[model samples]
Target: MNHPSGLSAAAVQVYRLRVTHPTDSVTELGCRAGLPPEVVVAAESELTRLGLLRTSPAGGWVAVGPETATEELVAATEHEILQLQVALGATRAKMQALSAHYMEARSLRSARGDIETVRGLDNIRAVIDDLARTATTTVDTLAPGGGQGEQALSAALPNDLRVLSRGCQLRILFQDSARRHKPTGQYVTRITAAGAQARCLSHLPTRMILYGDDCAVLPIDHERTGLGVIVVRDASVLGFLRWLYDHHWSQATDFFVDEHESPLGLSSVEAEILSQLASGRTNPTISAELGMSERTVARIVAGLMERLGAGSRFEAGVRAVQLGWVS
Candidate 1:
């Protein structure tokens, strides 16, 4: 049996045995394997760091503490295997789909391809308008890096708000970094206030817009800096985007503007302070943004970091993102 990481058969056996008998001391494990105690100890330490094992009070190793880690590792390995199978499957699927689409597009391409010129802002607006008109059930979007201009925002928001008004669902995903922007918060607040559901993920892929099952828009130009290209009428692409959205949505927390205003909780200001730390913002930046002194911000960030069991800002960000406090 080949290990996923391509470890030798003997090494795989050693790893499996170590995982199964985590309470065994290095001396015992080494004795069983006819290896040196130091080697076993080093291997156990490496596994523990990789999150495949947990260290015991007696300094022995056990399998990961949470059942989820074991399950996740197994699932990840299975997913890789399945992905290989799916790639083989998709060769046939793609050939059939491409042949059909190619024949259909041939005539249109011959007739209209020459007439098509540069796609500008107007073209983008037209697409957005078409999306708004066609959306029947839902719209899911992920926006990152804060450069979705005013016009696009206005067009998308009104239509989305209208859809929400008429009982259609709208869910938007934003990165945790967006929370640092006042304008972004205001926009999110406005949309959420109008009944559109929205949440923020700590980290996400490039920005995208999914309109029901009809269209998926991704950046064709500069994904990091410029506007994106929209892929319309592509069900397969839409399905992929939907799957990606669901995966991130599962990891994201339900974001409410007033989440901190619960019957028993911190005030909004305190919550924002905690959220800033969670977003990987430095105390000085938080102080500048929130209009507080750096010292106060440091104290607040420090207290929240301690409470969250985070040793560093990055860990705090991960925890906060997991809990949906900041993003």
Candidate 2:
């Protein structure tokens, strides 16, 4: 039978035998319980661990009352739960104070028309649509993560086309990892076919959407994009952002099938993976960062090792560096 207190049947049997004969020896307990001496000893040890048994003054085993043990266990569990609730309450209080400060700062910025915060997915999309509609010269974006979700791609298509139709140049930059994502590749190809400029780099510093020269939208939280966004209209900030964009664009490679291979004949994904490996990142970490499966990462590593004529990952990394495949 299953035990709510997590006692094994042997332990329960041994415990019952001990309770009935409070001064019984291990051998006697074993005989009465129909178990070997070793099993009885094991069950006794388990019972002792759970506070169901104790050593008497005469060195014989003693049985602890189940009600007493149960009361102690419940007290300990309640104490732990109360401590956790206290910690949670403290954290909530601090968070509320910080949130209030942030709201005040945001209101001040909004009053000056320098920054506007848009919360939630729906509101952010509305702001993006409005900005895209007003864009006159350029709509440049940097997508930092590997792949855009299907829903995001679908939602952006209409806004992208609207900008392009109004004679606004649409340029997008993505991380090298996105090149291996089939949906992202197809989306880029489709947009490029419709007069959009697309490029990719080994890494992107942030996610941003710049509409014209003065207006830009950026995520409020870098690691959690769905939380909200902040639109910046300050010329000084926009200038720096534009400069950052141009810097990455100058170093970025064109988004095309033919451009997938580098001068060393390594695919962008392979090169990025090799670089990460050489920097002492494990396959799992590389897979997570690149948004690829661990199995896919292993396969790619195996292929790279064979191509580089290396026997192990360390040797592959060394050879790749020597051959300038990674720095």
Candidate 3:
């Protein structure tokens, strides 16, 4: 009843005195309850509020029957508890309905700002593992340069395998340079055996990782050779990254140990060059990216177009996509 001093200390004294005396006045209560007159006045108000004491129009106060008061208190407490349970259930349903909207809102706000910043290789790897455990569709990765160190690959292999085991599509794009690194190749071999698909690209769009099509994590360092990473859940940004992934994926070499893609009667290098050409990279850019010279890149493009019965580069690209070589 909002008593200022808290659950009144005199409730004890009042209850004790009321139990023994049937007709107790405030004056007598003040004396027998060992309470001051002022305390007696406040305690009486509280007792009347609790229905433990009632005002008797004839004079002071009368005790409410202890059995009846206990029953009333028990009934009131049960009523409040039932009401609380219903309120809690309704709140939980409201939260469930808002969850999709919550994710959408995250995408919208994250479009303006990336939400998480992670650094240190170990911490970054921890975040990746956490994401993988809950990811729905696929785990897509781009590893530039060589392998990301033997230690890092070792740490990531278990969760990578787990994702594949759960029937999640696990696709990784590694640089051609990675083939020479024994540990990374071995890791790739193991995961591929577990139903993951890996490809090697002479060029990659970025050094990053994507969980499903909605969330992305990329290195903040220029070279992507360091530990800093930024985590993003922005829809627009993820869409563009996913597009880039498809682009590179089309041009990458399927990394089966003995299988090759030279159906155009071209060498492996020439087939790769033609794939990049179909994807719209400039000549010098291709040369620098694929470690080919200007002369070599020009010669191969000419040779490929001629062999495909195409008079121009544009014609070759169109033919390539139509043939499902660069789709």
Candidate 4:
């Protein structure tokens, strides 16, 4: 586990098996999970360290509630991600594995036209891509978290480009943290340049893809299952999604990235950082909270302090407020 997992697949599988079958031993857990005993042991160690699992007095392991476990998993995963090498042995593997199970159990086409379930990453991608391809007027997406990785973005790029070329309106709203992501930024740049309109909101409703006003696809598991996608053809539910998109869109700012990594004026990122700093957040806290690197947070703080002509962090806060950069 210390060597870094290609994805969190191994850990997630081990955890899933133990959580569902608390009495299972490491060997039993491995057998149930279809992983090696050593892998399950390693994953158990990692999960216990993360506080998601605990060794019961009976010698087996037990999980906390799913909600609590998921939050801990997310934080632990984010920390691990920051420590990973430049290459992305990203979260795709775990996402796919969990989603495959979801599809097997739940994926079904409904005749009533109320709702339907799609299975597998490929099928989800195919449906979403086809929707985007055949969209007559609009394709609106709320991609929260860190945004999709370079590979996912790359695969969807052609479909996205086609959407734009066909004179369809494409609007994507990403979390503000996404603009600071190197690869995510590249994709955003490409899409924006190709006539797609983009915005950055500090928060988002959910990960959803809405084609025009009716058809919609939304993730059901989010932080837990990685791939539980539900296709909602219900007009009322889709209307609410559109309303949610509109609400967030109105509050979002244009994603303005500075090429020089510094702006004569306080850039949106700088302003956001300054706002967090004003709340007396430390460098590490700011980095984790904003999904930015600690070094990046430090440099921004130092630069802002110098630019404010301030001798200390307190003075910088005052300057930022007086300048109306963050209030």
Clashes of each: 3, 0, 0, 0
Would you estimate the TM-scores of all the predictions?
A: 0.43, 0.59, 0.47, 0.49
Q: Give every collision pair in model 4.
A: none
Highest lDDT model number: 2
lDDT (Cα, tens digit) per residue for candidate 1, span 17-74: 8767766766777788887877666666556545666666876655654366668778
Measured with C-alpha atoms, the lDDT of residue 104 in candidate 3 is 88
User: Which pairs clash in model 3?
Assistant: none
RMSD of each: 24.9, 15.7, 17.5, 22.4
What candidate 4 gets wrong by more than 4 Å, as runs, is 1-113, 257-327
Candidate 3 wrongly placed segments (more than 4 Å): 1-113, 257-327
Worst 10 contiguous positions by lDDT, candidate 2: 105-114
What lDDT tens digits, residue by residue, belong to model 3 across residues 136-242? Answer: 78999987754557888888899998898888999999866566568888998899999999998766756888999658889887355465888887778888989
| Candidate 3 local distance difference test against the native | 0.77
- Model 3 RMSD vs true structure: 17.5
Evaluate residue 126 in candidate 4 and report its C-alpha lDDT on the 0 to 100 scale.
Answer: 78
Candidate 4 global TM-score: 0.49
For model 1, state the Cα shift of residue 170 in Å.
Answer: 0.5
Give the Å shift of residue 326 in candidate 4.
Answer: 11
lDDT for every model?
0.65, 0.84, 0.77, 0.76
Candidate 2 Cα outliers beyond 4 Å, as residue runs: 1-113, 260-263, 307-315, 322-324
User: Model 2, 98-123: lDDT tens per residue?
Assistant: 97787587457644248878898888
